[model samples]
Target: MAAYVGRGVHGQTVRLLGTRVLAGELREGDTIDLGALSTELDLSLTAIREAIKVLAAKGLVDSRQKKGTFVRPRAQWNLLDPDVVSWQVAAGAADTFFRDLAELRAAIEPAAARLAAQRRTDEDVVVLRAAIDRIAASVRGTAEEETAADLAWHRAMLAATHNEMFTRTDVFFAAGLSERDRLVHGAVHDDPVPSHSAVTEAVAAGDPGAAEAAMRALLDKAETDLRRATAMNRRAHDDHERGSTA
Candidate 1:
């Protein structure tokens, strides 16, 4: 899931089990049979146990005296973990994930923009400008390039806030945002450079109010583009289904 390149048997086992849990193939409270999994995946029991330890750290699984190792309730999950986010995105939960991301951005980013406008250094301005240039250059490039540029831009914006918590939040969300960008960037009708530039310029100008407003406007456009992209994808899927039946 999520183009993960597992490093070893332990890593591979973690990915396999993590993806299954996120995909709902292994539902909440369902016991994970380590011996069975070891047999099935042809991995060592130690590998399977190590994988479970990793998942437990991520809050995806837990053990109890009577229950054995079982999937935790979704509420217990570390949703902000990059691996968790990627697995959910790969599990066809992209729509819900995108919606949640939008809401989170709406709450955090405009305020971050305001702080950035107030606190950003000259170096921050340079980084933001460079990110914008990359975004502009990648507009017509491959989806991977475009997504990377967009993520870089956002990461720069968060870094400009000079707040550790804000920067950490961006790191947590980066994986999910990358997935969203890959899906929506190709479908968006409007050029993204200008909106991003508007926010950057406001921050560079040290205008907190303007920076906040600009960021809000940018998010509005992004939400609209996401809706359009989701609708188009649904229509395409419906058309294919109809054609299959015909």
Candidate 2:
């Protein structure tokens, strides 16, 4: 997941506070002492205020004359924001993030595949094929490479739909998907190449029903892989805890 922060001190301040809030170091409804933060971080009041404004825009914090600046409830956060999603994953919430991402993909990708099959141009087919090739190649490469290829493949799928709204949704969920891909790619899972190839072939053949079904199958496998990965992570953590206590 990409870190989107302002340049220099402003960006640093926002990242510091945002991570604290997302990581639960600063709980919801907890008031922020901007003056103390400014002193602590050695940033000017203007820089701290600017960071607060940025966070407020993302629904992370709010201020009033009497109440002062405070972290908002999680329910009020713009969870769909990529930066927020990135921070959450960074805060070790990858399991929850992956589960949410799978649910969202279940809602979006199958429909997108169907639309892509119906609406895709020859150029779209080329892009989709190239993306699949990248995915295949990256499977033997580094995890980050595989994650990037996976992201490109999904983006290509969405773009092929030729629907503005569907394409725009990519920005909101890309971070979560990036984290998901990294985890799944690094875990013990089935070969993603064949599943991805199936969807691309269906899209290229302009078979809407086949495309949707293939994408659904792909998502089913993805969810399974995610669950497996999460379970493995939990077991590893439990083992570490036991060893530490021993």
Candidate 3:
């Protein structure tokens, strides 16, 4: 029987294969045969090949002349790839995935905010202000609105840096940051108006130091919330394990 059987077969295959590799069910150096997968998944060789191609594109697998396809090392995996990160989270490692994301944010966002403050144009401020308005509306609006606005806000800040490389990394931030925001908005119960506004205000004022400090403070709150959420997830997982054993 196939590991996955359903509609959107190739896309499902990509997620299933990627998730297994991410969850270590298929470890580094593990080789897979396309023919074997076709037989197991009840899929055509063409389907299996396409799925493997997608995975290879994402750096999850590599094919050699004689070795077939093998799982790449975790270090070789594109951690910044949104699909990879989404698979990692879907494989039930959301706590660790998001924690690592928080650390990455801590490293990059403050500096980005600082640069945005230093380099922002009038148009940038307008966009920032519009995003902030959307976020404020999220307090009373749909979850989708909040997530969209939050993403826009973060993307705007990154773009404000005016650094080509930094702007391009918005993809790295997308899935993880959205997940983090959902967890935070649900769990922390803190009003983000003041915190988000502080950063915007600092940027608008062209205060790099204040913007950096505000961003650090914002992320510090996020990290704290994530730690709390992770602890809760650990407890829940432990409880589930104990129950299963019982």
Candidate 4:
């Protein structure tokens, strides 16, 4: 489907640039000067019109008979919509994206571990043991195999808890598991599961405190891994930038 650019496209381009420049400061009943907006963006009126139409459909802006366009309230924003995230990133509003993802982990992971400890079945343990064994066997092999085993191990770990949330989150992360796999996969020597296994065993044995502590250790490892991955990405990005300039 073709996307609308705003009134003859000029309006759309003008409006898009206006909204981004004044994204956070929008208020109802605030009249925008179409001429001034065009001058500021250095774009044609046709382009601005097209940009406005897109933003209007997105509910970020409203156009009235004569009141011009105004920003919508925050409550009306569709935050979880994928397009919204993409727009924010394009607009340079995602500085804390990864940090927020980790914050959600701190909120949800420990409880997931504790529940797995208390609810794990004997069969679940056996399955998890097999997954860990697969991971160990994949050493010095293909990264794809290591990633599959890592994802399987996480699913097995979540199985110990029987909590839907853990499993649901795992599903989301598992789909993107390869986001880290190519970098960290097959790089194992010491097992990542000793701490994870302790949590599962404690859960199966009905030990709450030990289960929680063990899960914490497993999560701590994750945080460390996440940091390492992020640092690597930054270094890569910097190298790319330098190479481009050179």
Write the residue-wise lDDT of candidate 4 on 1-246 in tens digits: 122333654554544554463345445445556677678877767656666666666666677787776776656654433344444444545445445545665566677767777788889878877887887776567876777777777788777778776877764444334444554553324466576567667776778788788777876776677667656666888999999999
Can you write out model 2's per-residue Cα lDDT over 1-246, one digit (the tens) per residue?
345758887776788788889999999999999999989998888989999998899999999999999999999998877778767877777767777778888899999999999999999999989998898889888888998899999999999999999998787678788777776776765788899999999999999999999999998888888889878878998999999999
Maximum-lDDT candidate: 1
TM-score of 1: 0.81
How does candidate 1 score on lDDT? 0.88
After aligning candidate 4 to the native by TM-score, how far in Å is the CA of 51 from where it should be?
A: 20
Listed in order, each prediction's TM-score against the native is 0.81, 0.81, 0.80, 0.55
lDDT of 2 at 159: 97
Measured by TM-score, the strongest candidate is 2
Error of 2 at 51 (Å): 6.3
Off by over 4 Å in 1: 1-3, 7-19, 34-57, 62-68
Ranking under lDDT, best-scoring first? 1, 2, 3, 4
What is the Cα-based lDDT of residue 42 in candidate 2?
A: 87
Count: clashes, candidate 3 = 1
Would you list the clashing residue pairs of candidate 2? none
- Model 1 clash count equals 0
* lDDT of candidates 1 onward, in order: 0.88, 0.87, 0.83, 0.62
RMSD of each: 3.5, 3.3, 4.4, 7.9
Candidate 2 residue spans exceeding 4 A from truth: 5-16, 23-25, 34-57, 63-66, 90-96
